[model samples]
Target: MDLKNKILQTPTGKKLLSEYQLNLLTKNNIETLLDFHDAENQKLNKLLAIKLESVLEIKKELDMLPWQSETFVETVNELDFGTGIEELDKFLDSIAQPFRRGRVWEVCGQTGVGKTQLMYTLALNFVWKHKLQVLFIDTKQDFSTKRIQDMLLERKVDQETSEKAMADIHVVEVLTSEELIEVLKAFDQQMTDDVQAALKTKVVVVDSLAACFVDHRGREMRRTRDSLLTEVACRVRKLAVRGVAFVIGNISFSQDSGTF
Candidate 1:
């Protein structure tokens, strides 16, 4: 089976891949699966192993992976948010300079603000202008399909490129902080040296980090949230240094943080 679509086609398979397959494919180590004489022709199986061996050899040399991997979908590096889209380009520019290698961004703002919209804009910019990939980690479950469709429609994102970008934008949802941690770790394992060197992580948006603190107990929630951001910032930056730019969103606790 083609590894790219295999996990998605099977419920159990995706879970297994998320749970265990990550470590097996990391940079320093790789695990191989061999089939026992089932194709009715021993030579065919031998040929299969040889083909796989060749794949492994090339993959090892590159020290990265194709965009089909769990990590590759939206790991876009050179964010050319065009001077179009009204004056929003100015805003995006002032916020950060396409997140340098080893850098990640956290977009924090008030409720009903354009924070999420900004993410969508950046997504479009990365895909259309630079043709880089992306990985969108949605914590709020608010990554709306309708909104994405609307954005594409509004910006005239073409059918083919839109389809391709939609397919490449890897999305993972998590309800708890711990699960988010696991997801990022698994996502990080897919990065290769070549991909990282290109500043290719388009952006990783958490979409409201403050909401994660609301249901918890005490003021300590801030600490927990802070710690989580620290870890997330750390991992994404490592990939950023290799050419991945990251963007995470949060809600502000003070007027000093500003609404815009």
Candidate 2:
């Protein structure tokens, strides 16, 4: 493949660079990976420089792989996963940008409105259909293997498939916002590791993000809460870039005025 085609083949390159930026590279005579690597230290505009840095980071990761390793581009799926609901999937597909990997989805609703249930369904659907893994971060200590098993049985899934699906849905309990951040950071590292098990994790479902910050009530802890949330967002985005889809569950607090 030529330089342009090679760059476009990688997820990071296709995501980070725009048509104009690619043209700019052509104008600058940076035609190959070797050429770009040599120009790494050259002065560039701020926006392009920042985008190039991320692409370069992905290149570095690919370089670290063994010569016999599979192509880096094949490590992640380029297609979108459905919500396991026919109507909902159709509706999302009608949108200009339908839900897909490398994106964060928020499922927010009032308590007892089936937010967590929806998260469970998504995780189950992803694992069962794709034979991929899901990282279910349970913040409220409500993750139940039995619940998932029951769901599988309800669907008339065979015993062997049910067992395999359950095994693929890895659950981790996190109590506080700090703990959530640490877990996300750990998952981020796992994504870059050369482990096949880590690569199988395509979706991360965080059940009830609000539960982690339930104690951050009053003015004193507002800043702390916001900081933690920002950190969590950053970590989530990092993982999403590596082709992991994130489904974050949140509770909507109702007040006298309306639900917020």
Candidate 3:
């Protein structure tokens, strides 16, 4: 009901200012100023005219708001998404592992740097340890039965564990980012609506977030693609806010290593 809550409802970047910013606009009608700046493509004058009288009624110059605490630390500490892989217990302890629920996670890295391996490991934790349901959105069409078999084999766990892992894990293949987005939007709502759903979803891993978002959008600055990625970021933030764990993958290459 308050400004802070409303601001939190919007994406972070979109919330560019505290009350301090209110001082810079032409008038003191804060609502009019916000509507103007946040307007996607609307005309400023027409938008402002409605509040012109309200602005004129204001007498005092807007005082800058008190400096608020940086939410980064709070958000990160609260960002409980990835599962705690027991085998990687030492590694898990080293990282700031946040207890997660169902969310979109974008795990990124350079190629051959353990993106896929980490995801499989995390998936195992979700099912075997946490007793959570994980819907793996496989866009690459690269999931191999052998890989799953091998992971369980290397761990030397029994067939019961392997079968249960495979049975509990749900996989869906999407051809593109647009398709992935649509499916995610649909699946999330469906999962929420299902009654007494045996599913206890803790995370959503996109294995490699880059593959689904390969199309370049602009020639001038090559920033177009990242612009599109903002939508995904919004979803990630929303999910995290709702306590879902998300593990997204990335493959970055470095010439020094000669591969990624």
Candidate 4:
């Protein structure tokens, strides 16, 4: 494939460059963009690489991804995963109108901001009110059953309902990224007939996805982290397409980078 065409085939190059930027590179001839893309000249590759990087970064910053375009139906059938905070739930509804199913949600904040608490609330609501199954994946295996039970009691939910609600949630603890990847890969097949029959699983929660990477640092580790995240994103997208909601938890130490 020609350079421009090849770039277009990849997610990084799937967006159209601004006409002004293209004009700068091609002198108003769109074909010149292709020429620059396919050029064998050493100097041209260096120049093209710089320009391409800039354009790709621009695309990413703008969220103008090829897969993100509104070329297909944009309406989403949603399910309410209420955080149990009335005002917060209202705010979330205004933002996404019930947090559409099959999409991934990331909850993050500093240590005391109730990120895990909100997750617990969401899981309980999904189970008790919605009568749906929730798969809770914990990296630290510290998810509190007692807390959920307390919340249930506070809400005046009967003991039978509380027991059933707790029963509907499945828990898995993984200490490594490899184990997390393996579980995600086999997720579809693991949704057995019995699992499918009791309650159609509506949510999967990963409490603190960042926990798996807490031990790693440096460039190579960062690359591995990014790759694993990409794989997770792909798998999550597939699950979402099949109508499962994914809720992810992340931790942040600074105000600028923490909350989602």
Q: Pick the winner on lDDT between candidates 1 and 2.
A: 2
lDDT of 2 by residue, 34-76 (tens): 4554353223334255443464454544333332212333344
Ranking by TM-score: 2, 4, 3, 1
Candidate maximizing TM-score: 2
- The digit string of per-residue lDDT tens for model 3 on 19-99 reads 444333335343432232233221322433323222222210111122122222123234344456544555654774444
Candidate 4 has its poorest 10 consecutive residues by lDDT at 64-73
What RMSD does model 3 have?
9.4
User: On residues 128-228, what C-alpha lDDT tens digit does candidate 1 reach at each position?
Assistant: 66566667777787788777777778878689867876765667777776677676666556554344512344455566555554555355554444445
Between candidates 2 and 3, name the one with more favorable TM-score: 2
In candidate 2, stretches whose alpha carbon ends up further than 4 angstroms from where it belongs are 1-77, 257-260
Which of the two candidates, 2 or 4, achieves a greater TM-score against the reference?
A: 2
Error of 2 at 2 (Å): 25
Residue range 1-260, candidate 4, lDDT tens digits:
33344345545445544334344444424243223422323343244444533443432332323333122222345555565568877997788646557667888776778889888878887777677788888998798989988887898978888889888888889987767877775675454323453227778989888887665555656545554554465556646655678889987666565322
| Candidate 4, pairs of clashing residues | 102-240
- Higher-TM-score candidate among 1 and 3? 3
